[model samples]
Target chain A: MQNLVDHTVEINKLLARYGVKFGIYKNQEFHEQLFPFDAIPRVITHEEYSELEKGLIQRVDALNAFLKDIYSEKKIVKDNVVPEDFIFASSGYLPQCEGIIPPKGIYSHISGIDLVQAKDKSWYILEDNLRIPSGASYPLIARELCRRAAPGTFKENNVVDNRNYHKLLKETMDYVNCGGISVIMTPGRYNAAYFEHSYLAERSGCVLAMYNDLFVEKNQLFYRDYKGENKKVGVIYRRISDEFLDPMSFNSESVIGVPNLMDVYRAGNVAIVNAPGNGIADDKGIYYFVPKMIKYYLNEEPILKNAPTYLPFYEEDRKYVLDNLEKLVIKDVAEAGGYGVVFGSDLSKEKLEDMKQLIINESRRFIAQEVIDFLDLDIMENGEPVPRKADLRAFVLSGKETKVWASGLTRFSRNPDSFVVNSSQGGGFKDTWVLSR
Target chain B: MGIISIEKANNLYWLGRYTERVFTTLRKFYRIFDSMIDFDDAEMVYSEYCQRLSIPNIYTSGQQFVDCYIFDPKNPDSLYHNMERAYDNAIVLRDELSSNVVSYIQLALDAIASAKGTAAPLFQLQQVVDYLFAFWGCVDDYVENEECRNIMKTGKYAERIDLYIRLQYHTKDIEKEFTKFVNRMKKTNMHCNLDKLAELTEIINTKKEFNTEYQEALNCLQGIVEVV
Candidate 1:
């Protein structure tokens, strides 16, 4: 472990050499910045991992069930386990995806469930990312480099190897593949997660594609080659959003979308990973009902806890949120990547009043949660160890079965005062080492 | 790896072109830079260098030429710009090239970027050449797709021959590059005008002085492979 800490600089240099970076647009110019890596491992005991594994698998299973029901039967709505307005009014709920069942009936093939440990050692679910969740590649690649830097440390510890993420991802695609080839479709190099898209494609042995490389012909999705020939694509693990997936189907002005692709998908000629309408299941407002969903769909109580969230859409919850505005963290339901998150305690008197008014008017637009004091993790800073705010994104894959990858992406905030640990918000990450014992 | 997309093929081709362009031009600038150090023959050699490459005479003095030609981000014909272009193309092709193979180009780009405004710019720029050499070697050793390799190498040898011709290399030197170019072009699935290729080869291997008819050869080489 000490050896891993000592070789942090060398590992970071290696990461830079491999061009491991994420792109961000500031002032309308795209800049690729290397994702900073912290050397320390976030160690989880074998027994604790067992509990998390059970909880994550149960959580993802319920989410997948909810998506299937929402898109087809509307059973959850009829039963009142989840409300009607939360389903229909969500921007995540695509009317275009109704009644369309993906192959294998799996919506979120790969689920990134954000979790944090409280100082009391209780784990709370922060958010769920079902639509093209990234960050697995960060820990996967970092662990490989860490092992090379400190082989003895790995030998001494019982940490589970996370290099099998690509294999698990491949199996998920293979399980859902209908016929021909598996392709990873990316928007382009300018995308924030382009490096992860390309790296996963390379590791998983899938064809990395852009919209120009793909076309829909004869009610089938095909990848075009340099020779102007087309090869049928059976499964596409697309990294682009649903709106930018098919120009004709969703956003008509999307130049990055493959035109008429949704028609092919609806025809069942190809499989789209995580399916298109998955945003509904991972919507921030939708998150409040997940534990209820687990009981409603799976007939079991949730093993993990939600962060005492309050959906402002409810009159009772809205009144509570308005009164406790200074204590709760407000999240804009529509935004992601650590954006649109406002800490009420950090707001001014005028802004706090404005927020209370806005919540009263557009109650469905936000969800409020009691801010949890995160269990800080130690990271190397200027050659000394210091604790920082961090959260883990545990990847749960629903393929032939739902399983949690032993490793998770642990992102920590560099600023001492901030609790936002997203890579886009200037957070550094560490590898989550789940002990095999 | 078995299938190549149109965008990737174009990027691989341009990546080859841009990298070879930087590697060859930077080496050429080294020779011209050494002559310019004498102070009297500065503008004359750089002027001829610019004319050979067919770029504008944008520099007013030797210092500006050395600075802008090697380091200026604004100069389109500068080594920095071409290296940046190579990076732009290479950055998007990580899956095909593999990150290990792409790292060499990254190393070269990093070298060129840090070499800017340094005390010993030429010495620092030598690492760019060394890294580019490593890039080619790593590609051959690691890349499994023969078509991808051939596509990128076609751009390499084609740009190399084009540069050799414009720089007025001897007919034998030009013929050696032409053979490698023809071999790689034939292996690629890229649609090429073989007649244009034959004419270009004839111009090089007519056992005649290539310097006399290099423009005609350059014209024939332009549309041989539609991408580059």
Candidate 2:
């Protein structure tokens, strides 16, 4: 571990050489910043990983099933297991995706399940990213560089090689491929996760395509080459948001979208990975019902536990949330990337009262969760080891079969006092090592 | 390598042009830097260099030229600006040209970024030239697509010829670069203004010295790519 720690600077330089960066808009100006990497890996024992693997696979399967049911039968909502208002009121629920099922009925081919281990040693899922979740490439490349930096350390540790993420991704794309070439469609270079979009495309051996490079003809998606050649697109791992995916179908003003893409998708001629309208399942408000969804859809007890969440839309939960306003963390259901999150403890008396009034006025817009006293991981700070808040985003790939990648991205907050560990909020990441033994 | 978009084709061509522009101009700057230390009217070399490239002589002194032309991110004609443009084009070509090959451009850009106002600016700036050479070498060796490599090289060689003729290199050197440009242009399926290439070639073939028809030569080279 010390050997790995000693090579942090060199590893970071390699990361920069490979252009491991995320862009952020600050004061209306774009600033591209490197996502700092720490050498100390978040090591998980094989037994622990085995448990996590089962939980992640189970959770992702349930999420996929819920998506299928919501768009088709709505059995859960009709049976009063999950309220109809939760599904209809969600900004993620797209009426355009109704009655049309994706190829293989897989809604989220790649699910990034964010989890944190509590002080009690039990793991709790904080959120589910059914949409375009990134950060997989960070640890994927870091593990590559780490192995090169300390080859002996890996051999000594009996760590499973996490370098096969690209292979896993390729397999997922291939599983749902209707017939032609698989392409990873990106908005453009200005997107925050452009590096990952391009990197994953390169590593997965898929054509990295932008909106202009693709077009729809005769209800089929085609990738246009400069030489006037065109190839049919089978599966598109679109990295753009759902609303901006098809200008003709969803957002008429979106210049980044392919016109009539949804028409092709509706015709069953192409597959969109992590099918559109997935926001309905991964919504923060929907997060509270996932455990119930696991039982309702899979008929199996949820292997993972949700971080004690309270949906404020409920009269009882709203009363509880309002009474305990100063002890909980309030999250706007529609917000992501650590935005629209307010910690009650960090709020002033006036601010807390203002938040309570806002919650009362718009209860459906918020879900509050109990702050889990998550265990902190050690990182080298100023040549000394110190503990920092961290969380793991375990990737669950649903192809022919759902499988959890052996490794995950473990992001840690750089600020000593902050608990937010998103790269957009200026956090560093470490490679997660799932031990073989 | 798989399917190049028209936008990507343009980016590849400009990537080639900008990288070469930086490489050749940095070598020129080094020579100018040397002359600036020993001669009084040495700063005039920048004005001459700018005039040849058709960029405005916006600097007040030799030091200001070095700062603005080499480091200022605001000046669109600066070396830093060219490197930024090179990266913008290279960023989109990661799939066409492998990441291993594209990384050298990133390294060169980083070199320039860190070299600003340093004690050893010359040493740091020289590394930028080294990285560009390495980048071209990587492109030739690692880029598996022949058409992609040719398109980029056509942009590269065309830019080099323009700079060489503008800076008044020997006729033999100009002929050598023009030959390379024509060779790459012939390999690419992309449309190039053959008239421009032929006129440039004719000018090179007929003239003993480029001093007389330098502007015409520059005009022909600039028009080589019919589409921007």
Which pairs clash inside model 1?
Answer: none
Give TM-scores for every candidate, taking all chains together and pairing residue i with residue i: 0.98, 0.98
DockQ of each two-chain model: 0.82, 0.73
lDDT of 2 at A109: 98
| Real contacts retained, model 1 | 0.77
User: In candidate 1, what are the lDDT values of residues A1-437, reduced to their tens digit?
Assistant: 89999999999999999988999999999999999998899999999999999999999999999999999999999998788999999999999999999998999999999999999999999999999999999999999999999999999999999999999999999999989899999999999999999999888889999998998889999999888778999999999999999988898999999999889889899999979989999999999999999999999999999999998888899989999999999999999989999999999999999999999999989999999999999989999889999999999999999889999999999998999998888999999999999
Where model 2 places Cα greater than 4 Å from the true spot, the runs are: none
lDDT digits (tens) for residues A388-413 of candidate 2? 99999999999999999999999999
Q: What is each predicted model's overall lDDT from 0 to 1?
A: 0.92, 0.91
Best by lDDT: 1
